[model samples]
Target: MSSSPQTGSEPVTAPSTTSLTLAIIVSCELMLMLDGTITNVALPMIGDGLGFTPAGLSWVTNAFLLAFGGLLLLGGRAGDILGRRRVFLVGIGLFTAASLLAGLAQTPWQLVVARAAQGAGAALAGPSTLALLTTSFTGEHRTKALGVYSSVTASAMTLGLILGGVITTLASWRWVLLINVPIGVLVLLLAPRHVAESPRHGGRFDLAGALTSAIGVVAVVYALVRTADHGWADPTTLVTLVAGAALLAGFVLVERRAAQPIMPLRLLAERTRAVGFAIMLLVPMVTMSFQFLVIQFLQLVLDLSPLQAGLAFLPMAAGLLVTSRTANGLLGRFGTKPTAAAGLLLLTAAAAWSATISTATTYLGGILGPMLLIGLALGLVIVPINVAIMSTVDPQDAGAASGVLQTTMMTGAALGIAVLSAIYAATVGSTSAVLVGDDAVALGMRHGFVASTVIAALALAVTLAGYAVRERQSSHTK
Candidate 1:
């Protein structure tokens, strides 16, 4: 196992060809990332249109999340054994068709099923984009390409809220899903010509590993989702949590024995890669919780319309795009550890600042600064961590690596929202005394931000500790 990350078995493509390929890959990623948050703004519209009970409405989001998060490992490995380009096309095509089905769905169940199909498609296609990008470029070109990818990734969720608000306001909520159709169609048609296929590894599919891991992930994510509605002590939550843990333990056993494991356990063996993955998990925990709580603050306390609330996130998106363009240079100059630490520091400050907001706090006075800081932090943080994790990955395990990285992120998001929402619920309590005004909601939201602050601080501590360990090892070698 060589540590050097070579531009895999892909042939050297022309610059024009590379640019087109990147465009296609980025387009696919944007669509997937957008879908993750786009429907959030339209949730009310969807619930009303489809006659969903308050409890049932959550499934629209959770269905897609469960499917995507659960199948990501299998999807990534499928690309390794099958073919990245073929898998990419098939995944995007399925996602596009599922989007259409969701848009046209007349019933709640129909839409939920379609959303799940979309997640399955995303799981298949998402890993290949990064795997392909890493394989297609090397040296400075790779860094710049990754910068672009990171920017798109970091900004897409915020952009999704903005676009969701726009589409839902002017047209209808259905357009939120339907919007992916043309983009997917374009990517599917152009991908084969531009996106070069990776050389597939020779191995039998790890069916047992796949089943255990996928089921385990789904069970865990379902448990997390349920925690938002039912407390952690609920019977369903406790049962699923234990079951998911057992299945995942079984998955580890299966992978260790399998000739061709879907998730190569060896990826987690390297300390740097492991640390990078941990940071990746923790960073999303803060971001997702921040977004979830802040959106509620914007609407419930501030009386902003959906469109206005979405527009408020523009500064964060702008900061992300600007900082991402420069993060490559920062990585080149300061190296990975310092750059990541700085980002996490910024994240801590932003979360701490956001924790001080009240019902009287205006958006410009309180929200804008933290939003901008958070955006910049994410760009700086995500790029370095990505580079650190993927830069030395063996091309043979690229898909699995990509899959694991994404799974960690999705799991982090799900876990963060559940935990923070639980904190909010606990603070608010069942008493009607606290329900008298928006002040209680504001206080609960403040507590959520405080928790986010603690999560960010913990991530920073871990990053610094990892840096110190690496430095000590380097001195010993000398």
Candidate 2:
């Protein structure tokens, strides 16, 4: 096995100014996250314009995901080896060029290729964004910065949905991809002047580790996605699942032997950070599944248009915006453990309430309350969880740590959607049979929400257990 890097931790360089730097990094992150789901609202239009078969059209989204999810670890390690600023700018430049190509694409395949390129660019940039945030800001300022960053991350999905609906309806589906071009260009121009360069470590790339981990995660995600579409027993799904497991096993062995491991195992050893990662993974799982089910309920049961359905989520977005601004202060006063636990309790309560929804439920009654609660809960949860994760990480490994966190969030959301889709199918019965009526759709959504409640409850239980453990250890120290 290769040894850990012998380099001393880099001293935090006090930036002369943080406003411009924070804006540039946060904007880039917002763009990357927005792309993750913005295409969803415009899928029908895209399929129509590109002449895609129903099944084939999904690749337009999956291509980006596979590339982005698979390459994230490598991207983080690259930032550590190369300068963060250099890699960040290169990624932005590539993303902007790809966005232009995607907007101009006439063929389905061309758009798919462009989307994948954008994903690769995003993978390269995403970790650097978090790394920069952690490196640039320290103490109370860092906490506040992370709070705003978390808010942006939490809101980006909804914002993307809202933007996708408006843009697709008012203009064309192509503009969803086109919009990034200008934003990317602006960031690229500003990044050089504002963002500081991170110190480069001397090491060879962990090529084997990267290849195996990327392929493994991609295969796993592919299997989950297919299982959601097809049944769990599909031969293709089974084969891919097994292949993914084997590749991931190989990746572990490779990492143990590599001179400079891309993801150091030591990061997971700390109890607080470990809890942070677990919550990051599970919390998004709950939120993503909620979004998937609620959107279906709005569209299928309520017979709302894409635009209307998108607009329905605005209350939650507003609540999130308001609370995220003050999350750092809450975290400072209450601490992450208490703050996070309170948030999970609220989330659990909201999910439990959402489970009672039916065809008779009204937006103002059942839906709006849960949406607002979820927004407030998420605002409280995300910032502290982020603070907990990055609080103890060594500056030298910031890129890798950020990569791991991002990977957890993406993989969690994907898995949550897949599992929840399966639950919805099972609850409604017959995956192949389309839902016959509003009642059927409503019942299915209720079942999905019930399942989501289970997930939130589990997350809360884990949080409590982590607290108990911390208490016992503290007593021992005394």
Candidate 3:
């Protein structure tokens, strides 16, 4: 919350000097990133194991996401106020403890509660990872380090699917949650030896901005979820949506007035950052919906086992790995703006292809094609947008700026999945019976996928328009 120097917002000009150290830090970061999506594939197993109702099971993901997204600013502020090294260890500690609790949960409620705690831990640790990177290296070295971070982030979704599939099939769903404990322990133990602390700054935390933003995101996401259950026309849904919008607006006002703002209004007002984050949000909205919808298609419609379904997503992981590695070089040649636009276009095309898929579609025909294209598009889009957002912000505010960048994507994906799930459910029929019955839901699921393509297409327009503006701005500067 505090815009202090000691919170480690100073830029990293020499990550090369500490390359080995940063490798360890990046591993720590990858662990956190892996946790975000790893549990996604394991959701079905966890629900069955805990005897959770369909609606009840959504909380396993939503609870963790809401807490993680809502509290990210607080986490970034903690890094600023508490000192990055101290806060990093604290976050690692909290997340590790929560992982153990989640692993041990015997009931559905217990699991949801534990997941939320784990989210709290994640929120704290996640921003610290970026802040640590900011202080760990500098200059062109910083760019390279960010590229490394970006690739890890790019592959996170697919990595989670692969890991969850193998682990859940080979071991138990609990192992998916339990996996974090060992990673966290390693990070907590090694963080101090490799990473140097940023010099401290003086200020109070932006408590007001943090609270309103968190509540606002919760309210909005809740409203989206309500739309699924009650339909979009329901009074409760409308009221929650209105309330969330109002609270988020108030959050803006609060940040404008606060001496130490968690999110700087000025940064958000930038055309590049705003557009970039919007594109960032939309990409996940498309992909996460694909995950929720398609996974069902795989298991129920295609009759694949959890392991098979998980393994089926391997192409996505492979595609991301190949494309993400070349992204920086692509960006260097094409420029950040054009590269982002191109990526969005590719993503929209992938969604278009994905929309054509159905329960009757073969793994090769329907699933693998979209998964690979989507993965490649993600590798292209995520890195540049993330780099743009973080790079545009003032170095002193990197923690808050990066926190918002990460939070928007996570919240959007979570809320996006919830809304998409409702759409699939209402249109396709209840998921429970589809598994046992004649599978009448395939038609509806196909329609849902097609409709989601509209979102990606719209995002493409936004990306194109934004980049055009950037091009004009560059021309003017010249």
Candidate 4:
């Protein structure tokens, strides 16, 4: 890892970055990822609080992602135009205030609105967190800083399940949302004193670029979700899908024309960046599909409780944490392509192994082994992909690059759940457990897991191409 750079700013020095500052950065990033999925576990309690229906429960999560994913490019632009530190503080303030409002919400809309507000804050600050670290350290030290940040983001979603389970179990569901207030306030206080303000890029706002990107993403996700209630052929669903695609295509054209695009076209055009984006998209696609399928296997087939269902994932989470620490050294020692390929290999193997699972199999022998491999391997893949995404980016466009990274991730999960869940439901022929026999449900889940394994293999193929092209290029350069 490289030491901190002397950028004529003493406060930006390595020594000035206290343990407190690191804690703040890590906490903030952790909360950002945590909020992305934490609400899933607390949905029952949230329903009780706000009187949500079974279908309405999903709105809590979708609301956040819609606003979060939609405005992410714009949020990154906001940080660039306004000031990273200033925008960060504003996001934290907004997030903390929204957390309070969400906790106190008496109606469904109030909670949904507050959650969307939180997502807006997340979109604003999430990009800047990485951008801030970019300016904070140089070379090797920068890599380590990024490694720490990357691990937290990768594992935070898993950690959220634990936090939400405990918080919702021990306290009221309101505590789930309220917990962010203290942590965010603490981070807000520590951020300014230690973190230096990056110089603002004085440029005109790319309004068309931002709207097209955000609207395009939301349209896609909303359409994907609509497939649950309306069949894939529904007119509303068709309109959303077409308009979303057209707007996204328009976004690409707008980026080429604009002087400063919300998404820099050149970044995506690079082979490495393109592969990284595809990895981001496909990894979540497979993982979310697996999650949807496996929960049914655990509860319907194996007869696990809601809490036990969540707990069944311990091996996956453990493997993820253990492997996240080792990824950096692997990437530092090996180039990005090899590292990513290994990760995709692990992921593919894990999912394919899961296809062997059946109703009579034991948890330890049947499930735990493959899940650990998936977690450990997934942990390894994230940093290499992040390295590739950030490496190709111009230093000036770091926030935009990071926003695009997140947008792909958010969109992928939504898409995965939609397509894979649809396949599962159609195959299973029943939505509710009481109506459908457990054996039939298990058969449907097996198909979904098998399909997910195939998706992972496709990702592996992409990584293999990455390996071949990158190595051939390296030899040519040498």
Steric clash pairs (candidate 2): none
Candidate 2's error at 199, in angstroms?
1.3
TM-score head-to-head 2 vs 3, winner: 3
Angstrom error of the Cα, residue 124, model 4: value is 0.4
- The models' CA-based lDDT, in order, is 0.79, 0.77, 0.76, 0.73
> Tens-digit lDDT track for model 1 on 403-459?
899888776776676667666655555323112257766787788889899999999
List candidate 2 stretches off by more than 4 Å.
1-16, 44-62, 104-113, 422-440, 469-478
Q: Please give the lDDT score for candidate 2.
A: 0.77
Off by over 4 Å in 3: 1-17, 428-441, 469-478
lDDT tens string, model 2, 256-347?
Answer: 88889988877888887788788888887788777766765776677677677778888888878876776767766666777788889989
On the 0 to 100 scale, the lDDT of residue 218 in model 2 is 75
Error of 2 at 180 (Å): 0.4
Estimated TM-score per prediction?
0.89, 0.87, 0.91, 0.87
- Top candidate (lDDT): 1
Pick out the ten consecutive residues of candidate 4 with the lowest summed lDDT. Answer: 469-478
Query: After TM-score superposition, what is the CA distance of residue 216 in candidate 3 from its true location, in Å?
Result: 1.6
Q: Encode model 4's per-residue lDDT on 306-422: one tens digit a residue.
A: 466567777878988887888766766676777778888989998888877766666787777877787887787887787667755766788788888887876676666656665
lDDT, model 1, position 192: 72
Best by TM-score: 3
lDDT of 2 at 272: 79
Question: Arrange candidates by TM-score, highest first: which order?
Answer: 3, 1, 2, 4
